[model samples]
Target: MKVQNIRMTATKKLIEEAFTDLLRKKGIEKITIKNITERAKINRATFYAHYEDKYQLFDEMIKGAATELINVHTKEENIWNQKQVTCLTQAVFEYLNQVKMSCPYSYQNLFPLLRMKMLNALKTHLESLFNSNNISEIKEFNILMYSRIIYDAAEVLVVEKTNLTYTEVIEEISEIILDNNQSF
Candidate 1:
């Protein structure tokens, strides 16, 4: 039997929204379960049943949002292309534009956990490119480094969107990947 089961969608959504609303107003350190429960209008028992504490609740919310964003970016059915990558990058930019503070806060809070998930997804995409180009597999260490760099770069880029156009950002990344492949 699983110990953690988020069975009730409505209650879960309420708890999550309460945290988001609270987060927008103040930082996580200031948030407590009492505040969340009161804001959510749900009892503490329901909150505890789904989550262990405030940190988990914060993690759950941030993680859920990260997964949703990643899914939105990677869910395209068509063959991968530069156009699609550009569109995905622009979408990232647009998402940041819409929720500049919230998105970065989520990224900062959840990136370490979410980074691996995103990196794995990126590695699959990069693997496809390697296959298409007849390139060899990247080493595990290199993939790990690349993944972390990408996460850091994207997070920084999201916060610094006003300084760079989406196309400019995408082109710079493409150039770096191309240069890296040529060097290897």
Candidate 2:
């Protein structure tokens, strides 16, 4: 059983790596199951056993990446504070930059879908932390607004090349967030 699990893990990794390679070179629409299996050096049956289709694989990839990206900045306690907020904002900027660098073609092709997914994920993450604190002073609408502000700022940081250094961008994000939000 353990060996089978290991083999499964290895097979999934190969499929994921192949899909990612194809993503880096071209859009998902151009990538087929045959392409992935061929690139992965695996049979079609193996790919089907792992994923139902290319869309499923793509979704799983995006979800895994998003979870990892969010987890990197999440605290063990999920505490809501200025520092936590800064970390969350920084995570978005850094993660987007990484994606842009590693998968420029995929990033360009999937920017809209990526943006929506990232935004919703970021909002949900922030909401969870905010809800945990149960701060009566900060309303739910405030959480939504704050998440948008942070996401929008982070998006700008990734899209534009400004003179502002990374620290400066973080500082600015923190300032805007902290200034508007004092309760958290």
Candidate 3:
């Protein structure tokens, strides 16, 4: 059972890497199951066994990446703080930067999907933080609002590729959150 699980994991990783490579080279719209299977060196049946279709593969990849980012960034603490927020902002910026560099041609095509996935991940993390902290003063809506605010602010820096340092961006985001928290 353990060996089977490891093999399945390895196969999925290979398929995902192949999909990413094809996405970088040919963009999402042009890539097909055949392209992915050829790149992955896997049969169509194996691909179908893992994913129903290309859309499912894409979505699973995005969600997996999002979960990974969240896990890596939030490994230490459940409470939200400026430092954690800074780390999250920097991690996101770095991730986006890598995506831009690696898939310059497909970055624009992939940005919307990446943005939505990242935002959902951020929101999930923030909700967990809020719930764990037992911040009864802040409403659920406010937590959602703050999550969007943090995501949008960081996203602007990422999309613009501003010259601002991560620390500078972090400071700005901290202020935004602090100011908003005061109101709530």
Judging by TM-score against the true structure, name the best candidate: 3
The sequence of per-residue lDDT tens digits that candidate 1 reaches over residues 51-151 is 99987876566454443564576566234445545544544444444454764344345444455555565555545545666656556665555444455
lDDT of each: 0.61, 0.78, 0.77
lDDT per residue for candidate 3 within 11-61, as digits (tens), equals: 999999999887777767788999999999999999999999987988887
TM-score of each: 0.68, 0.79, 0.80
Clashing pairs in 1: none
Better-scoring candidate (TM-score), 2 or 3: 3
Backbone clash count for every predicted candidate, in the order shown: 0, 0, 0
Off by over 4 Å in 2: 1-3, 76-81, 181-184
**Deviation in Å, model 1, residue 104 alpha carbon:** 7.9
Q: What is the Cα-based lDDT of residue 110 in candidate 3?
A: 73
On lDDT, the candidate that comes out on top is 2
lDDT of 1 at 90: 49
Worst 10 residues of 2 by lDDT: 175-184
* Per-residue lDDT over 133-172 for candidate 2, one digit per residue giving the tens place of the 0 to 100 score: 7766777677777777777778778887788876777777
Model 1, runs deviating above 4 Å:
1-7, 64-68, 75-81, 84-99, 103-117, 124-136, 160-163, 180-184
- Candidate 2 residue pairs in backbone clash: none
